[model samples]
Target chain A: MKKIGVLVGVCLSALLLASCGTSGSTSSSGSKAKGSYQTTGTANSGEYKGIITNGRYRTSKSRGVGVSQNTENMLNLKSFESGLTTISKDHFSPKSYVFQEGQILSKGTVENWLGRKSKDNPEGLNPKDNGKKDANKRNPIYVQQIEEQDYMKEENGKLHLAGITIGIGMNRKDYYQKEEYGATYTTDIPKEQMIAEGKKAAAKVLARLRSYNAVGSSMPIVIAMYQQAPNDSLVGGTFYATTVSNSGTQMGTWKATDLKNYVFPVTDTDTVPSKNDADSFDNFKNKIQNFFPNLAGVTAQAQYDGDSLQGLNVTITTQFYSETEITSFTQYVAKAAQTYLPSGIKVDIQIQGSDGSVQSFVARDNGDKGFYTHVFSSY
Target chain B: MKKIGVLVGVCLSALLLASCGTSGSTSSSGSKAKGSYQTTGTANSGEYKGIITNGRYRTSKSRGVGVSQNTENMLNLKSFESGLTTISKDHFSPKSYVFQEGQILSKGTVENWLGRKSKDNPEGLNPKDNGKKDANKRNPIYVQQIEEQDYMKEENGKLHLAGITIGIGMNRKDYYQKEEYGATYTTDIPKEQMIAEGKKAAAKVLARLRSYNAVGSSMPIVIAMYQQAPNDSLVGGTFYATTVSNSGTQMGTWKATDLKNYVFPVTDTDTVPSKNDADSFDNFKNKIQNFFPNLAGVTAQAQYDGDSLQGLNVTITTQFYSETEITSFTQYVAKAAQTYLPSGIKVDIQIQGSDGSVQSFVARDNGDKGFYTHVFSSY
Candidate 1:
C-alpha cells in the first residue's frame, strides 16, 4: 500500500518542509483534500430485451450495444479519490484517488458498495452523513458523473440522463491473470447480506427517483458498469437490476450477479467463418488486447432491456490496447464489427487513448463508426 | 481451401480397379467415413448441485457433481489420434447429457432446454416460417455421452437445482488482430420466420423439463463460453444470433448473447506470480500476455453479480504475456497459479509439454473432479 514517488501535487517548499521535520512522516494536509464522491447516469434512449441482443437468440436483425447482463439498467460511477474538502456541509468532491496510476484498484469496488459515512455522528452539520441512516453498509455500486466544473446542490446538479456527462473516472484491472502485490477488494459480508444490501440500494435509488417525479412509467431498467476484475471468480464490474431516475440519476446500483456467460442470442455468423481460421481470430484478439492492456480479449456479449416497441441506443465501447501492433488489430475488430453484427444492431467501438482521448466508430448499413483508417498488419 | 492431405479409404487393389488405366489422381472413401477418436475424463461420486459428482465445475471446497458444462472444456487441446467415438448418449439418463467427464453443466438446463421434440406440432409457431418444418431446422440442444465403447441415448431423466449454475469455455483465434475478416452476431430476426422455429424448439425443451419438474426449480444457472473478437470494429466474432442443431432431434442448444466482453468469474489470486524474487501487478500482466503466443492481457469491463455476499466466486482462467509469446510464460503462469490461487476457487492450469503432451492441474478444494494428468491440446 506504500506508494513510492508521487510528486504530482506538493510544492517545492512543502516538500522540503516535510523532509526537514523529524520522523519525516507527512501529515494528510497541504495536498488537495480528496474524498470519494459518486454520481449517477441515465441513458438518452430506449431499452431493449436482454437475450435478444445476445448473438444466439436473435429474432430480428437488430444492432447490439455491448452492455453486459450484469450491468444494471443504468450506468453508475463513484470517484475513488481520497482528498476531500466540502464545498459545503452537503457537498464534497475529490481531486483524485489516492492509489497509484496503473495500480490495479480493488478496494474502490468495496468502497462503492459501502458508501462512505462520516464515522462520527449520524447526521448533523455534516450533510455527508445524511442523518446516519445506514452508516456501515456499502452498495458496491459506484456511479460517477463529472459534468460541471463546479457542483452546487441547488443548481449544478449531480445526475444527468443523456448528453455526454463527464468528470467521472474509472480504472479496469485484468480478469484471467492476477498481479503480485496487487490490491483487490475483499469483504467479509455474507452472500445473503450482500443480497440484502443490493435490494436496499435498489429501493433507495427508486425512492430518490420517485421523489423527483422522474419516473416515466416505463418498464424497470438495469444499470451496468465494467471495470477490470482484479482476478477472476468473485466477480468483476458491478451489475444492478434497476430502472432509470427521472432526475437523470442512476436509480439503483446494486450488488454483483453471477451471469457473466449465459446462453442467449448468438450472432448468425457463429458458424465457423468461411475461413474458420483460428490464426485470424487470435490475431484479432491480440490486436485488440494490445490497446486495452488490462483486458484479456474482446468478447461479444449481448444486452437486452424488456422495453417493447422502440428503437434502442446501442453502444459498444472497447478498452485500450497496448501497442501499435494491437492498435490496428483492435481497430480492425471494431471495423469488422460492421460485417458480422446484425443489421439493426447499430455498432460503435471506442478506445480510450493513453491520454484518455476517445477514438470511436459507429457501424451501420449507412453510417460507419469510423473503424478503418486503412492500416493492416496480419503477418 | 486446399486441404493439406487426405486420408485414403480404399484398398490398393480396389483403388487400382477404380482407376483402371487412368493417370495419377486417386480417391479413397474410408478415412473420411470413420475418423478415429479417444477417451479421457474425470468423474466423482454422489450428486453435487445440478452437476454430477466431482464434475468439471467442482473445487476442493465442495464436490460438485454439477451438470456437465461440456463433455470437453479444458482448453489448449492438441491431439489427433484415432478411434474416438461416442460411447453413449445421455449415459446417466434424464433423457440425455449426463456424463462422468462433464460436471460443470447444469442438469436442469439440459432437461429443460436440450434434446427434445415437441409432442404437439404446436401450431402458430409465433413468427410464421418460410413454412417448411425442415428437420434440419430442428436444432435441439444435444449432448453426446460416451458409453462402454458405444453411443446410446439416455431417455427419461431428471434435473437438479441447488443454487446457481455456471458454464465455462475458452477460445483462441487471431481474429482481433485481423481487421479485414472481423465479424459479429445480432439478435434481430427481421423476417419473423425463425421465430416460429425458435418457439417450437423452446416448447419441446419446456415440455421435457415439465416432465422432470420435480427438481430444478430453485436453481439459477448460467452457461459461459469465450470468443476472440477481431481488434477492428467492423469484424471478427458473430453479428447475428444463431441456434445450433440439425433437423428432427431438437437438441436445445443455443448460442450466447454477444457483448463487448464475456465477463467470467475470477479472483485477484489469478495474478501471474513473480518468479526469482521479482514482484508487482503490472509485471504480472506483462508476464500473462507473454505466456499466450497470441493473447494480449486480461479482459476489461466486467460486471459483478453478488452485492451482499461475502466471498465471490472468481476463477481467473488464463495468463499469458502477449498474443505472440512462446509457451514458457504459460508454464510459469501455471506454477504461479498453484502458488497464488487458494484451495477453493479450483485452479485448472495447463502447460504444453515438449513431447506433444499437455500437463494440467484441476486444483479443487479437495476432490478428484480436480485432476493432475496429461492430455493432448484441442483448443
Candidate 2:
C-alpha cells in the first residue's frame, strides 16, 4: 500500500512534468486503454498470473524496432524472454504474482548498461573498449541486450512490484568491422567466457535495480543467462543457466537449467546429446515420410532437459490442398506421432502447404493418452 | 494546428479530473510509450505513411479480448481488417495520410451499436425484437461489429483528422436458438441482402461520426462492406465492395473490388473462374512435385482480380531436412515458379517443415526478371 502511494506520487509528478508521458504505469485505468495484450502463459503451469498491464501495447524503451537481423534471431530473443519467465515461475509462483513488462529500468539507463564501459559511460556493463582495430585485441560486445520482467503482488486493489527477472542475451559470436565499409571480422567468444561475462553483467544490473526506490530492498531478483545463436542459425538459442539473489546485490550460486534445442534428424552425430531422442525422432520422421509420398520435408526442433526429451515441435510440408486429403493426412499424423514419438513428452505437429499455410494440426500434451487433430477447412 | 490545441486541452482537462488516465492521446510523446505497434502496411503502396500511434499497443475499446470463437474466425477477422486497409489506399493515398487505429468510437457506443434494438436500447443498430421464438418470425442480428480507422494529414508537425474509413462486418450466416441453451438454428443471409444491410448500417455510422466535433465537416469517408466467412472456413472472406463519400454524410455508388481468393488445384470446376490460372497452377505444382519425391504437399492460395491473376501464395511442405537438399530444392522451386506459373503477377512461396517453421522463401515481384530465393540456414 505504501509502494502504491509512492508510485502514484511519482506518476502524478511525472504527469505534471510531462516526463513519463504514457509510460503505461499503474495510474492508468487499464480497461480504457487501447489494443489487446496477451500473456505467453502455459496451460501446464495453471496459467501465468495477473494482468498488471493496461492491456495496451507498449514498445520497449530501447530498441523499439528490435535488434534481431532476421526471423531466426527474433525467435531466439523471444524464446529467451519466455523461457526466463518460465524459470522464474518456479521461484515466483504465478498464482501469487502479477506479470508486467519491465518498467523499472529507463531507456537511458538500459542503453548505458548495454554499452561498453568507457570514460563517458562508466555504468556500461560490457568490458571497456580498447579502441583497437585488431579482432583479437578488440573487446567484443559480450552483453547484447538486457531484458527486465517485473513481478508484482496485489495488496488491497493496487499491485506492488515484488520481484525482477533479468535476461542477459550474450553473444556467442561477435561480427564487427575495423573501419567504416571495411571487411567484416568475426570473433567467437568461448562459452565459458560468455557465461562469466553474463553473470558479471547481471550482478551490476541487480545492483542498479536495487538502487531504485521502486524495487524493495528485500526483493528477490532472478537472472537468466542466454547464449544467442549465430545470425544465420535456423533455430534460436536456449537458456543454459539461471541464478537468484534473494536480497541485496549479491547473486546465489548458478543453477544449470541444462535446456538444449536441436534440429531433428541431426546430420552430425557428435552434436546429438541423446541417442535415444535421435532414434525416436528418426522413427517418427520415417513413419510420416513413408505415410505420404508427396511429402516435401519433415523437420523438427526437439527440446531436451539434460538427457530427457521435454517437447518436440514438428513441421510436415505437404502438396495436398483439399480438405478431405488434409483431414485424412492429419489423422494419420496423429497416429504416427502417438506411436513413434517419445512417450511422456509434449509433441506438436503442423501440416502445412508449400506456401506455409497450416493445413492441419496434431498435438499431444505431456502425459496425454492421445493426440488431438484439427484439419483446416478450405472455403 | 487548432486540433492539436483542442486535443491537448481535452487531454489536460481529462488528466486533471483523472478521467482519461493514459488514453494514449497525442499529448504524450510517442518515444516514451511502451510496447510495439505495427501497421499492416504493404510494400507495393510505397509504405503506409506516418506513425500516428504512440507506438504503444492498445486494445480495441469494445472487444479487446476479441470475439472470434476459433483460429478460423480469428483469421477471418484479421483478413477483413487488413483487406479494408488495402482497399482504403485506393481512395485515400497512403503517402498523404497517417493511419491510426479506431479511437473515436467509445466502448459504450460500440456496445450499444452491436446490440439488438429494444425498448431500453434505442441506439441499437440491429432490427427490433418482436418477442417471437419462431425462426422465421424472429429478427436475426445482421451487423456484428463496426471498425473505424482514422486518416490524418500533418500540418505544422501535428496530425489532423482528414478522413475516416468504416468497415462493417456483416453476418452471412446467423446461428441462434429459440431459447438459451436450446436447439440452435442457422439463418443464411443472401449476398444481396447482406450488402443492403451493410450499406444501411454504414450510413448510420457515418451520420453518428459526423456529429463528433473531432471529425471535421467536409471530410471524406470510405465505407467497406465485408461478409464474414462461416466459422468452419480456413480462409477468410474478402472485401467485396467499397463506397466513398467525398463530402457530407451522403455516400456514392458502390464500386466492386473484383478481388477473389481460391485454393489451388481446384477440383470444383464451376468455382474456378479462370481456366488459364488453373492450368498454370497445375503446371507449377506438377513441376515442383516431380522435382522432389518426398514432398508432403504443395498447395497455393491464388488471388485474382476479376479473371486476371494478381498474386499467388504457395506453400511447399517437405520431408527433407538437410541444408544442401533444401537449398537445391529451393532453386528448383524458384525455377519452376518462374517457368510454369502465370507471369506478370507477384508470387510468394514458402518451404516449411511439418511443424510450419519456414525453411526457405522464394518470391518474384510483378515485372521481375527472376525469382529470388533464400533457404534458412541450419544451426
- Against the reference, the lDDT scores of all candidates come to 0.25, 0.66
| Model 2: lDDT of residue B284 | 66
Model 2, docking class? incorrect
Write the residue-wise lDDT of candidate 1 on B19-90 in tens digits. Answer: 532321111100011212111111122211112121111111212221132213211110000001110111
Q: What are the chain A TM-scores for all the models, listed individually?
A: 0.29, 0.83
Q: Which tens-of-lDDT digit does each residue in A26-82 have in candidate 1?
A: 210111123221211101111011110111111111111112211222122111110
Whole-model alpha-carbon lDDT for candidate 2: 0.66
| Top-DockQ structure, candidate number | 2
Q: How well is candidate 1 docked (DockQ)?
A: 0.01
Candidate with maximal TM-score: 2
lDDT of 2 by residue, B79-152 (tens): 56656667777777878875655668876888788788888888898999887776667777788767777776
